[model samples]
Target: MKQCWLDIRAAEGLKSVLCQEAIHRGFDAIVADDPADLAGLPPTVSRVLLPGKELPDAFGDADLVIVDPVQHGEPGRLAARHPGVRFGAHVDVTDADSLAVACASVTRDPVTVLRFADPTNIPLEIVLAAAADAHGLIVTTVERAADAPVFLGVLEHGPDGVMLAPSAPGEAGRLKDAVERRSPDLELTELTVTAITHAGMGERACVDTCTYLARDEGILVGSRAKALVLCVSETHPLPYMPTRPFRVNAGAIMSYTLADGEHTRYLSELRAGGTVLAVGADGRSRPVVVGRVKIETRPLLSIDAVAEGGEAVNVIVQDDWHVRILGPGGAVLNSTALQPGDRILGYLPRRERHVGYPIDELCYEQ
Candidate 1:
């Protein structure tokens, strides 16, 4: 399980509120400038001291110590000098060299506190790289609640913990919830092609997600509620047109999409600012914001498929060669060359959903 900490050293007026909330949320510890500041804290919650001038004489009583490598030398040496004392080096995320040093220092000390003072200029890629580099604990401090998911979702395995400050009230709980949520992963099964037909001209939905998608990543859409087909995005380079790595020419407007595994939404209902899951060929998924949804009248091709379990599904997509699907062994198959009996990757919902959440109820969609 991931860990979380609360920094209340500089919290003047909101110190008590933040400390109590941190205890309520089961944080690992509360970091303060002086150990006396955490006197009233619950016994279950550990206390961490950020010694300024010098090491405290009661260091053995404190659970953790945070220090700066530049001012106090290496944290590992400090820990070695004072036996039984655990120390964590404080690092600024903006400094590349400092970030690298901090990540490397994790080999000597098991914990590193990565601080991000500038919320507007939070370097997400650097933070992710640092987190990947650290073999031990990588704790971060963000300025806002919105930045929580970014740090928690950037890599397959994100940071081990985060330090919530008192700057944002009532945000620690929400940040904890976001970090605790499991990363998205898709379960794809084989669907045999049943039929392909020309469905004349219709409005097709071209979903442009906020994140840049890879060639193997796309959206899942189909006609049936239980079964859905993986529609590869427009990231593949074509002889006729340039690649749009951020766009997925999903399907006809009425087609159903597996928005976030539990919930299904119509392709036509998708609009800017809506959320969608970008699925890769390996079945791993990540949430993406809808940047734009383009609807255009174009010739359509209807694809019918059925699984071995007797489940049948269909989708009408733009009759263009650029639109593709994932076949057996993760091979890319163009829609224009699809034939009967060709196996393609698809998904089956475990249970029905209501308003984007799972519920124990019967529901159907045509």
Candidate 2:
């Protein structure tokens, strides 16, 4: 599970507020320099102490310990000195080389707390790179509530957690909401294309999500409950017009969408207030709200596919140049150029669902 910690060393008065919010949002732990500041905090939250070189007597009671590499020789040596201690490295982001060394050194540790000494000048790309390098729990410190989502939403699976400082009071709840809403990476399966046929003119649904989708992002849509194909969004640049970076010209109104986990919803059922999973070619998904749904009469094409288990499915899509499905090796197969034998990437659900929830009863969709 991902962990989010709250730092209350600087703004002690906001400890109660931050701790309460952390407990409410199911945050992992709270970090403080003084043990007295941890008073009255809920037992559910792990109490972390950022102690100096000399471990205090109360250090034994801490759920986790964060040691600065500058003050304490090296993280590995410290771990060896204090055997069985849950130690994490606290590195300052301003020192790029030191930060890289700390991130590399703490890959084997259980956690690493990255402190942004200059929050105003912190580079997000550097932080993301550090996260990619670190193998353990990556806990970042945020100066404000808005900074939380920026780190949590960057990559498909962002940081393992964020550390909220008391510099921003009464903002923990908002930060928690942002982190909880960020979706994790998803899995994409490969399906063999069986046939491609013209379905004539029909009304297709074009879904526009609220998030700014990249060129590789799209949604999963299909005809059957078991096998679903990835419907690329309108982010690809065309020769005629500017790209719509927020829209996924998905498929027919009746096409099934793998929006809900272990369940599916019809494209026509999506609304402006509903949420859908925008998946990238790498199979990482993030939840995006539906801002609008456009249905228009256009020439349609039906695509038939078979899964590894011999289960067959199909999806009807608009016969346009922008409408595309992800092919094997992450290739983008435009709807207008699809052939009968093209292999495409899809999702094969392992179980049946009812009312958008997984169930044991057998279900079928044409």
Candidate 3:
């Protein structure tokens, strides 16, 4: 997980409320310009003091003090003079010389706070690459809490932490959430096919995503929210058509597909710029952007499957040999060829859904 630091320097009257909320949200550190502002803060959060160019004579209860080596003294010498407090180097990267200095500080300083003058992430990417093997923490300052995700994803490894000077209340919590957002793997089950029938003409959805999906990757779709079948992507070879590596012939327009781990959305509700979970055969899942959803009238087939616990699941899709679902050990089974007693990969959600949000209540679907 990435570390989140709250900068309360310009919070004015809302400083106390922001600090309390930051601590409640388990923020890694609270940054302030005045030493007095760092006092009375709980030890649960690291107190980071970022003073002006001229260093203060006395340090209070600050856990870490960020300073410019050129303005104040060297970080090591400052640490020696103020043994009770830890020292970190701050750098403003505006040009090649400043970028080099920031890169050097990342390796030598125990903690390096960087402010990039350019809007582009090139400078920070260079610093991150330079600190690939460095043991220190690299905290990059962002203009807003919303920009934390972009910086946290730089070079894939990203910076060790991000510092945000929130403009208003509750921004710290938002920043914390952005820093800790992650997709978890699901436990897929092997469901046995119980029945199959021709459901006549209906609209089915073809989920086109912005990213190319792997052969083992696809989306989960079902008539009922409690149970869903793994629908494979169009990454495999088709006899008459070129491969559509970014498309998944999902299911009927009204079927439920996962928007994330905790939420589901109907295929009809999916639109361009929306997100859906792209799950792999091994149960790993990631969010992929929806480029578009193609809905067309076609002869539909209904598939009925049962989980290990005897839970019934249904998925309706276009009745064609080209449409496919996944089986155990990454086996691809054509939807038209499914038979009774055939085993396919599926997932059983614990609770029923209401408006896409999981809710613990009695709900039934056929």
Candidate 4:
């Protein structure tokens, strides 16, 4: 199982139901309910009150990002910016389909999410190789908004350390004094932040994907940011991430990208007899670009064709790193770094064969 950054959203009761579902399904939980607390949070399962502004600069790694439209106080425009994070705004209490669609929409972007999961429900620290989630902790003395100066006061207790000042006046002075007081034995650096949220020392509803050892195998969905695949060496009767948290290239293969050499979403067990395909699949019929490859750019575009609903009539195979069809498949393909301006075009697919345009003859923008 993977360690998940579960963002509990109240967009129509996702928060009300998310925690209970995770618990009933037996997951570690981290509850951050207030919006103010989320100001400088690192990725963790938190209930947020979205004011429609973007998440703070201090927000850290997160696979799942949920938003409740009510929290935003208007149309949920916040969903557009974080294309990589799964999305859902509260429509009503019975809107499971809408929630699922929102999750799918955001996770379809091209990026591999790191993961860790545990089958037995254990501590989050068990699977950390290094700092997988947090880069640094944002600590404060004041537990409430009124406590901002308290954070400054507490800092004074620490061992003498480097000082940083914000452009703001009162905040700068108080924080400096706090550090001088509680200074510990270790080095402490002072940074100014209006607020911060953290990974509470409690149940984390989800984990980084590798946190669990599973015996079974099934489709791993990157449909949600926090989605993960747990390998206990035995398959469980249910789905890997039942929440439908992320999106995959297809309904079958969940996807991920390489980060610092560890596998995520889908684990690379290195078992024998598996062929790693290098084809970069696309949704177009025109040749795709491989900016990191032999050429600088190439066109491999495809159109979504459906007899009825939204489904592609054909698929595109591009030679570019960003064939524009990025999704779950770092598992199937390997990446080769390209010098600037190098690119390639492998193949392209089309919705309907134009009377004059064969998949081979069609040309698209690079």
Best by TM-score: 3
List, in order, the clash count of every candidate structure.
Answer: 0, 0, 0, 93
How far does residue 105 in candidate 2 sit from its true spot (Å)? 27
Error of 2 at 336 (Å): 2.7
Model 2, backbone clash pairs (residues 3+ apart or across chains), number = 0
Better of 1 and 2 by lDDT: 1
Q: What are the runs in model 4 whose C-alpha is more than 4 Å off?
A: 4-33, 39-65, 69-366
Worst 10 residues of 1 by lDDT: 117-126
lDDT order, best first, reads 3, 1, 2, 4
What does candidate 1's lDDT look like per residue over 185-302, in tens digits? Answer: 8778999999999999999999999888987888998877678898988887899988888998999998888667467888988879988888888899877899999999999999
Estimate the TM-score of every prediction.
0.76, 0.58, 0.90, 0.17
lDDT of the candidates, in the order given: 0.79, 0.76, 0.92, 0.25
TM-score ranking, best first: 3, 1, 2, 4
Per-residue lDDT tens digits of candidate 4, residues 146-245? 3333222232321111122122323333433433332112111111111112212221011122212222211221212222111011122224433221
lDDT of 3: 0.92
Cα lDDT over the full model 4: 0.25
Clashing pairs for model 3 are none
